[model samples]
Target: MHLSNQGLLVILVVGVVAGWLAGRVMAGGGFGLIGDLLVGLVGAFIGDWLMPQLGIHLGVGIVALIINAFIGAVVLLLILRLIGGGFGGRRRWI
Candidate 1:
């Protein structure tokens, strides 16, 4: 199925918001705009899967989607930090 432009825009907004929120929750986790977008997009997938498995359901709609993605992004960021993941030689976000 083809996605409408509005749908794509909505997704982007959700991703950015979710990623930003996750970053706020996890200090030094924000990977900037593009990186946050990617993290958010991937996090959305992880959240969609992990939440259900954990018996954590946030209901439906955009707000729920954002919450789900934020939770997932926080997890992703936590893992990255655990693995010593950083951009270039920068360990702390500036």
Candidate 2:
């Protein structure tokens, strides 16, 4: 399905938020705005595919999309860590 400009924007925003949330939950921090957005978009796609195969359904609407994206992002981060290439390590604070 093709999303309109507005729809795409909404999805992107949701992805950014979901990715940031996931990063914080898994990595103790985010990988910055662009990184989070990228992770979120990929996570959204992953969630869209993985959830069904795992016998999980999040229903429709933006909220569901966020939840799906968040779950997927967390999984993605975990996988990346297991592969020894995730955005790990603590952030430096001055």
Scored by lDDT, the top model is: 2
lDDT, candidate 1, at 79: 86
Clash list (residue pairs), candidate 1: none
In order of appearance, the predictions have TM-scores of 0.85, 0.86
Q: lDDT by residue for model 1 over 1-94, one digit each (tens)? A: 9999999998899899988888777765577898889889889999999999999999989999999998898888888877877434555566
TM-score of 2: 0.86
Global lDDT of each model?
0.86, 0.88
Global CA lDDT computed for model 2: 0.88
Cα RMSD for candidates in order? 3.4, 3.9
